[model samples]
Target: MATSTFRVNVLLKEGVLDVQGKAIESSLPELGVSSISNVRVGKLIEFSFDHEGSSLTDEEQTKLTKVCHELFSNPVIESYTLTEVK
Candidate 1:
């Protein structure tokens, strides 16, 4: 059977305070790692399906995006981008 992979990049929206990201950024100077600004963190989630390429229909992609928004991301402060991995 043919198989494929896709990914969802989940990240906090701009202007939202990212405590973890800030802490890491502030700590970097202490650790002697400089020049790293705008150090925001995000998550990558991959999904494997028993389908080939972008064979999944638009409706299927829509449903999967909905799932990503509802189940994987916090709509209040987070947004996500979906990509079909080759």
Candidate 2:
């Protein structure tokens, strides 16, 4: 079996209100950083898979994406992208 690495990046949708980002944005000026306009917070998830080949097949990749969407991310508020690194 070969090994594969997957990287998942999840971020809030555009126009979605991020309270944490807003707070950080508000505090930037107080910290003497006035050039900052806006801020957004997101998450990065990395994991590896053991497969027979160097990478997963297209069907396998699609199944993995479905699993990610159903289990790892909120479809309404968050969007995610998956990449194979190795």
Candidate 3:
């Protein structure tokens, strides 16, 4: 069996208030950083799975999607993207 690596990016949806992002943005000027706007904080999760064959199968795709929805992110306020790492 080979191991496949995946990266999951989880972030708050548009129109949702990102309080932590706001706080960091507010403090940037004081930290001598300027001209940065629209700051948003998010999570990056990298994981690997053991499987057969060269690439992920349809079932693996579905399972990863389900995991993203059920575990890594909140379906109501957050969105996630999954990508295979080569």
lDDT against the true structure, per candidate, is 0.84, 0.84, 0.91
Looking at model 2, report the run of 10 residues with the lowest lDDT sum: 48-57
In order of TM-score, best first, we have: 3, 1, 2
Which candidate do you rate higher for TM-score, 2 or 3?
3
Model 1, 1-86: lDDT tens digits are: 56778898999999999888999998998989998999888888998766434477676677787889898899899999988787
Runs in model 1 deviating more than 4 A are 51-54
Write the residue-wise lDDT of candidate 3 on 1-86 in tens digits: 78988899999999999999999999999989998999999999999988778887899778888999999999899999898888
What are the per-model numbers of colliding residue pairs? 0, 0, 0
Q: lDDT of model 1 at residue 58?
A: 78
Q: What is the lDDT of residue 3 in candidate 1?
A: 70
Candidate 2 lDDT, 56-77, residue by residue in tens: 7887777788878997789899
Candidate 2, residue 38: how far the Cα is off, in Å: 2.3
lDDT of 2 at 59: 79
